[model samples]
Target: MQLQAYTFADTTEIKDLVTRTFSDSEGVDEGKLIGNLAFELLTETPEKDVFCFIAKENNAIIGCIIFSRLIFVRDIQVFILAPVAIATEFQRQGIGQKLIRFGLQTLKLNGIELALTYGDPNYYCKVGFQPISEQHIPAPLKLTYPHGWLAQSLTNNPIPKINEKPKCVRALAKPEYW
Candidate 1:
């Protein structure tokens, strides 16, 4: 399998992969929601505010992940990882984790300081994410599952404590997403 940066041609396949993977694990409705979310994050969001990555095997997209910039008043570079999905047939083979790691490494190489994500802490923990309180680094919106807020320093230093609430990219600004 090869990890690749997303291109316009990958849009349809990426959406289908996210939709089908979530439909298999979650319900069809949830699959649709995330699939739409991924599409918006790609097509609607500004290029400067988003990064998309994919895992492919023989030119077929098997998994995908997205990271959107989080703007804060203070000068700091941060991004949020979200809506990760791996094709149903490819799940449990570490493809998702590998894709995530590749995405994070790219972000780090580009000088990103902090990386945050909201999801299953147990799964995220394996990739260096730790439970982070909103008080430490406020999310764009009130979190429905506060405990799921996780973060890790992409740089060598620790994540700084910032009370200023950060704003997520337009595609991820919806209340339902927080």
Candidate 2:
């Protein structure tokens, strides 16, 4: 499979992929929830605030991931990974991890200081994520799974402490996602 940045023309297909993939794994309700989230992230977020990557085979998208800016009171450059999806058949093949690594590398090149994600610690830990506490970097919304709040510094410096909570994009502003 090939990893690359997503294009505008691929928006609908990407949304569908995320929806179908999540639905198959997490049930219909979750599939629709994440699908809508993906749609909003692609269509509503500012270009500068989001980065989307896809994994494809034979020109067909098989996996997708999104990273959106997490704005803080300070001028720190941080982004959050969320709502990743791999086609049901593509899971366990490492496509998700590869796509995430690609996205993180791209973020580092673009000068991102840190990356955060809320997800399965076991899976995310494979890609260098570590469990972080709210005291270290406050989340925009109260986290239901505080242990899943993870982060990694792209720079040599360690993850810094932020006095104020960060703000996510409108699509991820809801509490249910946090």
Residue 157 local lDDT, model 1:
91
- Model 2: per-residue Cα lDDT over 1-178, one tens digit each: 8999999899999889989998999899999899999999999999999999999999999999999999987788999998799999978988888999999999999999999999999999999999998998888999999999999999999888888888899999998887
lDDT (10s digit) by residue, model 1, range 98-157 = 999999999999889999999999999999999999889888898999999999999889
**Could you give me the TM-score of model 1 versus the true structure?**
0.98
Report, for every candidate in turn, its global Cα lDDT versus the true structure.
Answer: 0.92, 0.93
Candidate that scores best on TM-score: 2
Clashing pairs counted in every model: 0, 0
**Runs off by more than 4 Å, candidate 1:** none
- Stretch of 10 with least lDDT, candidate 1: 169-178
Model number with the top lDDT: 2
